[model samples]
Target: MLRIGLVGIGFMGRVHMLSFTDKPMIPNAYVKNGKLVAVCDIDSKKLEQAKKEIPSLEIFSDYKEMLASGKVDAVIIATPHYLHPLMGIEALKNKIPVLIEKPVGVFTKNVFELNEVASQNPDVVFGLLFNQRTNPFFVKAKEIIDNDGIGKLKRMNWMITNWYRPQKYYDNGSWRGTWAGEGGGVLMNQAPHQIDLWQWLCGMPTKVRAYCKFGKNRNVEVETDVTAYVEYPDGGSGVFVTSTHDAPGTNRLELIGNNGKIVIENEILSYKKLLVPENKLNETATANLMDPKNAPQFEEVIYTKKELGDIPWGVEHAITIENWINTIEGKEELIAPGIEGVKALELINSMLLSTFLDKEIELPIDSNKYYEELMKKCEKSEFKDTWRV
Candidate 1:
């Protein structure tokens, strides 16, 4: 079996465990194909708790020692957002495949460095836990776009409000609100899935203009609310909106394309393709590719929709775990490998920098410049209730 080691027993760390057990998000191979050999955390209490949950596990307080022991064939890093790249680098240095949790890192530079380490160690597989990639709804959406059903996407919009966080939640951990610790507020934590979706479905926008409110929802330093505008090279445009403050949450996606319109609400997807432009359809029953206003109606094709459950750490994390295992075995390509991590990291950093600059940030941002700036912010900042244990 593919032996695995997991580090960080916080919310995400537990999430990684649950993610592996539930096969919906991750492929069954990860569960049946591998084994969870060890669990690690810096907090002794947390380590003890993890043992209670998984009594048979080989528990450790030192991840470095765990790595050196070579008991596990791969590693999963679910530490805080900032620790991802650092832990990932260490994992790769040991020639071990690593599946790191999202945001990849607080800044682009860290992600790039981690990627460099990944490239050098091709023998070792590296993946980010962008599990939403494995969701059926999103998978269906990608298929539609690939088949050109949307037909040269003209515009798209997302209003995701179900993600709500309270002040107490941030207060629970001193590192929760700080830029140095968590990296960002909603953008990094609550909305990375949306970010990955927006950029993934429509392609990374050439331009990203965003406006955000800092400490808006609670007494923390980060954006709780954000609305971003994006522009694609082919004149395709999309809007990404998110908030951790709204109540009676509303989640929706609206897409308008040359051939049709698509909407996904409450996980029920629907779409209609107009065959004729209204300007011409008034005179004759004709379909227009340029402007299909009267296209034949088409209802959204329902893929065997799975009830959205408690969103796991993400969909691909476990599958990525398996990919790491297979990569080690020379069995297959990494499911959600390193380059994808870089892209996801780039999108997240661009949005944060957009808020800071009060301007639209360009794609393919200068990661090196941002890393230095982020480091400066981290060095001077103080953590409120940072974990001392």
Candidate 2:
């Protein structure tokens, strides 16, 4: 059995721990050939609670000690946003397989460093917990896209404002909305999964121009609302609008391509496949806009959750964790490799950088410049390290 060590007993940490248990917190979500052998957290109260929940569990106050103790064959870092890369780097250097929670790091620079270390430690499995990748709707969307069902993507738009958070939520944790602690508001915290999925399905954009509102309808220092415009390499453009302020919010993704259109909303995937390519129709139409021949025919298909079976919340996290363990055992390849985590991070940083500079920022942004700006925000953050414990 793979002995796993988990760091950070925060909300996500606790959830991850449940996956390795004999009975998972979520239905049909238990892992095989792995068990959480040890847990590390700086919070004494949290550790005490964990010890009570897990009998005969090895606990540590320092993650480095946990890594060096030889009690765990692998480690999972579910710490704060900024600590992800740092902890991942340490684990990789120790030649321990690691699975890190999302957003990789606050900035691409640090994540790049982590990626470099992971590259050097080729044998060690480096996985990322991008659980939403396992969602059937998204999985189907990817399959359709890869199969050229939506030939030559022309445009994409995601209005994912369903991540509503109240002021009390941010107020509960000192690090929740701060630059030094959480790194970003919606982009870093609530929307990383969708942002990762955006790139995963639609591919990375070449340029990004964004408008962000900090503390909009919320008392957070980081952006709570954002509207970003992006340009793909093929001259295609897309828009990403997100906020934690919308109530009964909207979660819709629409993609328009040369051959068809795809939409995912309310857990349903809708595809309108055109009988003739739009470009071809545009070039060969026999009549004016009112002509019957000019009107394109579409074969629409809708995929629903009922057809796919109801996937319980938090089950995807367990699936990802199990995939990580399987990868470590050479039983399966990782669904979300840790290195690909950088793409989503780059998108997050680019959108924030665009808003910061009030211009369209290019992909593979100047990491140094973004880091410099991020540090400025970190320097001004009022959050104290003591508050974390």
Window of ten residues with lowest summed lDDT in model 1? 22-31
Give the C-alpha miss distance for residue 233 in model 2, angstroms.
0.9
In model 2, the clashing pairs are none
Candidate 1 lDDT over residue span 230-293, tens digit each: 8889998988788888997788988777777777786676756665532334544434545665
| Candidate 2: residue 297 Cα off by (Å) | 1.3
Q: Which candidate comes out best when scored by lDDT?
A: 2
Q: How would you encode candidate 2's per-residue C-alpha lDDT over 245-277 as one tens digit per residue?
A: 899899999999999889999889899999977
Compared with the true structure, the alpha-carbon lDDT of candidate 2 equals: 0.90
All models, RMSD in angstroms: 4.5, 1.9
